[model samples]
Target: MLVTGASRGVGRAVAAAFAARGDRVAIHHRDSAGLAASLRASLPGQGHAVVRADLADADAVAAMVDEAAAALGGLDVLVNNAGQAYPHPITEVSYREWQELWARTLAVNLTGPANVTWCAVRHMLARPPGSPPARVINVGSRGAYRGEPGQPAYGAAKAGLHAMGQSLAVALAPHGISVASVAPGYVQEDETNASYKVPRGPDHAAQSPFHRVARPEEIAAAILWLADPAAEWASGTVLDLNGASHLR
Candidate 1:
């Protein structure tokens, strides 16, 4: 399994979960050498490999996927979890800034995954019949549908990912491959705690029935379940991991 952006947050948790389940894990990190080392030390399997790649660079992205596939002998799963979020008021956002934000977000959250998925699909199709199908689980955000006021680019990128996952599911089904997206709500991470803090007030607690933000591991659990071999029938489904905060 190849887990991009596995150095920290939900990606790290997902990698750990798979490793705990006795699956070989290829951890992809951009620059977090310390975090990568920590993950290597923590993972149970001897097949754990750490890969570094600047996901924004096309060549690097391709190399990352290829290297991971090689390390794992064959790619069985891909978890696209690398993403960026930049919040700017519409009036204050400049064209250049918007372009940079959109490009970066789209590259990592959309195009990068699409590229990896295409490569994995080709590998799956070439495999012998009756083999377990490969799985692609995209880590999306609730903002894809909820419309974050200050982060339109992030929302748009995630929405594109959802569409891409659904399309790929249809395109790869005949080849016995599965593609799905996991859209998580406000995940309770250190960064979110520092920057996008939801006040611990009565009104805030009442905003959702769950009364708290999602833990990183909770989201990882959803990804794990979706990536399970038995979940082949659930392909193309955008499983919402939100706490029913914005139920429509």
Candidate 2:
């Protein structure tokens, strides 16, 4: 299994969880090579390794796919958790900023994962029998449905991610490759900690009726389950891990 952005937060937790389950993991990070190395060292298994790649770079991403698959003996599951967001809300930011934000956000959050998926699917198809099953579980955000008024590009990218999964699920069904996504609400992480620590915390919690944001481990657990063979029926489905924050 390959977990992108595994140096911290949800990605980190996902790698650990998969490793705990005896799955060999490849942890990926763009510039967090040190952290990625530490994570690989800390994982429970022996086959785990660290990979570096700028998701936005097509060549690097392709190399990552090839290298990770080779290290793990073959690719079975891919967790597309690497992402970045610029908080340049349209109404407040200059037009130039908006363009930059959109381009950056879409490239990393949407296109990067799509490119990885394309390469991973081909790799999986060429793997020997008895290798891990082909699974692509994307980490999206509830912002796609609830709307990220402060970061519209983030919302749009996540929405596009879910759509991509749905379409690919059908297209890849015959190949025994399953695709799905998880749209989680405010996760407890550095990116969201400020929001939850502010006076607005209560409001954010109220949205979920859980009185709190989700923990990284919780989201990771969901991804692990979805990546398991038992979840094949969940292909084409966007599982909402939002705690009912914004029901569709």
Candidate 3:
């Protein structure tokens, strides 16, 4: 299995969950070499390795996919957890800044995953059949539905991601590859994250009526279940993990 942006946060939790189950994991990062290496070292089992590349760079992303396949022996699963979220409210930012932020967000969150998925699909298809279908899990955001007026690009990118996964799910079904996405709301980096450190406020407990925000591990567990071969029927589904923050 290969997980992009596996150095920390939700990506880290997902990587750890797979590793704990004895599946070798390839952790991808743009510049968090030390953290990636440390995560590889700390994993419960062996065969875990770190692959580095800038997702925003097309060539780098292509190479990274190949490198992950080589390092992991085979790529059966891909988790596109790499993303960026920032406040780029139209009211505050200038036109130039607005364009810059939108470009950056779409480049990383949308185009990057699209490229990675394309490469991974080709890689999986090259392998012999008879095995279970390969799986691609995208980490999206609830902002795609609830709204991200403060960060329209982020929401737009995530919405595109969900659509892309659904499109690919149908296109790849014959090839036995399942693609799905998870949309989470107000995820807390961890309990220790400073209030201001979080996008919406650390006191997001009120948002869901649960008096608490989503946890990284909770998201990981859902990813794990969705990756199971039994979950093949769930292909193209966009799961909502907002703790009822926004019902649709």
Best by TM-score: 3
lDDT of 1 at 120: 62
Please provide, for model 3 over 30-66, each residue's C-alpha lDDT reduced to its tens digit, 9 standing for 90 to 100: 8878878888888998888899888899999999999
Order of quality (lDDT): 3, 2, 1
- lDDT by residue for model 2 over 102-152, one digit each (tens)? 999999999999998998888889878776668999999888988989889
Cα lDDT computed for each candidate against the true fold: 0.82, 0.88, 0.90
lDDT at 239, model 1:
86
* Global Cα RMSD, each model: 2.5, 2.4, 1.9
Clashing pairs in 1: none
- Which numbered prediction scores highest in lDDT against the true structure? 3
Q: Tens digit of lDDT per residue, candidate 1, span 51-125?
A: 888877888877877888778877878898988777765778888887887787778777877877776666656
- Candidates, ranked, TM-score: 3, 2, 1
Tell me each candidate's TM-score: 0.91, 0.94, 0.95
For candidate 2, the lDDT comes to 0.88
Model 1 misplaced stretches (Cα beyond 4 Å): 128-130, 190-206
